[model samples]
Target: MYKATYFAAALSLALFQSPAVATADEITILAGDLPPMFNADGSGREAEIISTVMERCGHTVSFEIQPFTRHWKTYASGTGDAVATVPVGMPLGGHQSDVYIQYQNGVSFLTDAGNTYGDLAALAGHSVIAFMGASDILPGLKDAASSFKSYKEVADQIGQSRMIFGKRVDAVVGDGMIFAEYNRQLREQSGDLMFDPNQGVTFQAIFEPSSYGMNFRDAQLAEDFNRCFAEADAEGAIEAINSAWAERYRETLGTQYLGH
Candidate 1:
């Protein structure tokens, strides 16, 4: 009986201390469509940076789309391993990296008439539409835009471009790089598309840059990413990827926000 008992205890110990099975190595990322930053299709500047950084850290990363309103809910429910470009004032219950991306939110207009309104206060009497989450990420822009004759919120950046071109609204507010891309895509999509006659759009930077961070559920994984990011960042890999995009939108991004 003593020998049998000892053998059972030894077996249990062996099982407990045995090499753990290797599961699929992947980190699931969740985010909404916030163009030039986070895209549902996984091609934004931040998305590119995160994937490159995470992969360099020896892990495969995948992205899942959720609207801004529902992305956090899904992340909190333990659906995603990490969240990219987390907005301000959102709950930071888990580990998060340093500010990975700083968005210089700005106002964009299609026609010269739309440019007349220099500041947010001056936009009170105009019809305006802006990207969703602007209210949270850009409170001042949202508040000032609220006093407009009519204010609307949209999910996709393309919608903003459509509204501006159709004369549906006087101005649109969003990131400079995104607005430029939206216009280009619309123009490309408009070949034999519609009878829209509008041109010369630009985004005016009026608000302070808002910072967003990469939040992770696993503390160790977060730390790991942070370390890898530091090395990649030191080599200017992130900035190198963004410089061309930033340079492309220099005029619309304003003279103040391009120092990075």
Candidate 2:
């Protein structure tokens, strides 16, 4: 019966080594309405990457999208599992986690007509608009709130656009992608208005070149995700996702920033 006993031990070892046990854990990802990265529709490139990687590792995954600030608060409160698409160089606060993805260069500036802004210094005397909680990304501008006007809602983009057209604000300052997307939507609603990117007169990158990644509440899960993300990046899956969305954005919006 020695052979039978040996077979039983081998089977037990195999069961213990299987991935199923690890997958029994669930991972909830908290995200914001950051496009091309984390979309409210669950169709962002980062979401796809996370799904592919985590699924292969046998973990069930889900997402909750809130405002940028609220997403961080919820994750920080330890009410959920993790936060995804956090901008590079931003503090994680209580959520000490690993980086899972690195996005390419992104710019922030005003777009008027077909023109784009090339420098932020040009906006020194002018009023600039920004989101409520994005100060960390634009620390200099954030501290100079008195010099520039700020808004707390996403609809502020529309307000700023109108303000620019009406000469109420000197210029709008925010994520280039968000601004482009907002402008495109307005163009659809009102057929006669043209945004000359050429009208984008003043520009500046308050933040340095940065990337984004996922943050986890559990260190073990963060390790697992990092390993999976690296494997996917190596396999060209991440690149494929970015390329697919880039093409789609260009086809639909005629701009790359809108998709991101």
Candidate 3:
């Protein structure tokens, strides 16, 4: 009887000490339709990274691509379980994960323009265009741009690319990859021969890289994501994805660009 009792206690302890398996969950992750980063076809750097991290944590993910600004509204309306590319310290009641990606934002101008913006203040009298919500997210942008000859924020980065390449704007501000992709698109389309798409441009690294994270409505999922993200990051999975995309963009644009 004593032997039997000891065996039962040992078995109970063993069972209690065993690792728990996470129940698989279907996670809907809302993202913006940023090409080469978050695509509508559910293929991009962020898509792959989110999939890798969620699957590692025993969850399946589906991306709902929306406009850059529209995704925030959709997330606020309780449409999805998580949102990606959330800026740091945004006022939202959700569990935020570690920084997953960073966008290199700065001023871009024609290489032969012989002009330089060593600082945001230097752009005092130049016409500039930027992505939507740039003033709200990027500190000092609105203040500096207030002094510009003209400054406009548009939802379509493709337009930004066109304006800058056409010499219609003195400068454009946004992600390097986004601008490069749009420029490549302009080159492919007909009837845009007025401005050279292949014209060399230089990006003035004036702004610090903008870091972003994933926000999850479910606390438990956010916890799992953080843990799994750390694991994947340590394994260099994120870097590999970033590197592959960077190479593809370099080939596509025929120039080196900021890789995510």
Best by lDDT: 3
Give the lowest summed-lDDT range of ten residues in model 2: 1-10
lDDT of 2 by residue, 138-200 (tens): 545545555444333234555555555555555566654445455544555745554432233
* Residue-level error in angstroms, candidate 2, position 211: 3.4
**Model 2 stretches astray by more than 4 angstroms:** 1-26, 87-97, 101-116, 133-136, 142-155, 161-170, 188-206, 251-260
lDDT of 1: 0.68
lDDT by residue for model 3 (151-209), tens: 99988788887798889999887776677667777778987377788888776656677
lDDT of 1 by residue, 127-229 (tens): 9887765665565764676589998877777877878877888888766677777777787773564537347776667766767777677777778788988
* Each prediction's TM-score versus the true structure: 0.78, 0.64, 0.81
Query: 1 or 2: which has the higher lDDT?
Result: 1
lDDT (0 to 1) per candidate: 0.68, 0.54, 0.74
Model 2 residue 183 lDDT score: 51
Model 1 residue 73 lDDT score: 54
Give the poorly placed runs of model 1, Cα more than 4 Å off: 1-24, 114-117, 190-198, 248-260
Backbone clash count for every predicted candidate, in the order shown: 0, 14, 0
Against the true structure, candidate 3 has what lDDT?
0.74
In model 3, which range of ten residues has the least summed lDDT? 1-10
